[model samples]
Target: MAVKTIDDTENYTIEWDEEIGAIVFTWDKYVSGATFREGCEALLDAIKRRDAAKVLTDTRGINAHDAEDQQWMQTEWMPRALDVGLEYSAVVHPDSVISEMDVESILEGMEHSGAEPLVTSDMAEAREWTAEK
Candidate 1:
């Protein structure tokens, strides 16, 4: 059977580095009619295939998303993370509104688990944080 390619993407930025085991994502470009959660789930699944548990999402390049997207990420996506033992990380501009909301969404996930996401404007800092014990 054919798999779910929810949408045929064009401008999305997604890459995985096997050497570093990092799933890098840059979602600054918006594509209409594509659900953000589906994109992320595809990414998460892709990274999981190679046991890449660390992620650094760049949200500075795109527009802000709605509450449903945020709730979907925090409530639905995060809980599923337990299955892969993933550690979340992010590199976001300090002034991006979407960045703030994403951090807040991750914080909401903390209520469900002791695990808190590491976020920073510096990519290195976020990567280091995610790498910590």
Candidate 2:
């Protein structure tokens, strides 16, 4: 599918890749609600189109975005993702404050919602973890 961009005050992009499944926040920027929602939507779309696919959220700018938004995503969006068929094997990003969240909170949210995310530092690790074992 073609890359979709949402101008929700925050800058972000979403795309569906046959290989990666879902690619969210394909920029070197911070995370935001707009980005998270777009991602949640993209995951849902991927689930509908494809099967349970991994997600890659380029989080190079996690520090640049509002912390509350990130927390909200962790609390709210993650659960929503699980409700769908989105099984997120990993989250690609560098070490940042965002990584400090309780894995249980994130996983519980994902489990309650539909995704099972394995947060990582980059695409390589995320891909490796998500790859069918």
Candidate 3:
């Protein structure tokens, strides 16, 4: 399947992976406030356009995100994603301790969201999980 670039910026890249029918978001740096919002919006648009229900997010390069942005992702984006048929999300955790903590915080908030999220340090594992029906 062809890979389609949804949004590519200096800080991150969001893409459509047709092989697994998932939208992939890879962060190259820490993002907050406006940058985070823009990335989320692009991701939402990609999900809708691809009719994707699964997501593979690679956060290994990111240092961390702002608390407010994390909250927005959990409270706002998560529900909106679910409403659009999102059912699963696989996150490849960052190496930095602080970044891992931030990811954990977001995951905690996602506990009650409709989508199921799996956190891991392995990208291949994340892809495998997202590939499951």
Best by TM-score: 3
Determine which window of 10 residues in candidate 1 has minimal summed lDDT.
1-10
Candidate 3 has an lDDT of 0.82
How do the residues 1-133 of candidate 1 rate in per-residue lDDT, one tens digit apiece?
2222222355556666443456666764654334567677776776567576676676666645666676777667777765676655554545666667656665565535655566566766665665563
Clashing pairs in 1: 28-61, 28-62
Provide the TM-score for each candidate, comma-separated. Answer: 0.71, 0.60, 0.88
* Candidate ordering by TM-score (highest first): 3, 1, 2
Q: Write the per-residue lDDT of candidate 3 for residues 47-128, one digit (tens) a residue.
A: 8888888889998887677889989987888778888877888889866667667777887755576568888888888888
Residue 109, candidate 1: C-alpha displacement in angstroms = 1.9
Runs of candidate 2 with Cα error greater than 4 angstroms are 1-10, 22-28, 31-52, 96-115
Error of 1 at 45 (Å): 0.9
Q: Residue 92 error for model 3, in Å?
A: 0.7
TM-score quality measure for candidate 3? 0.88
TM-score of 1: 0.71
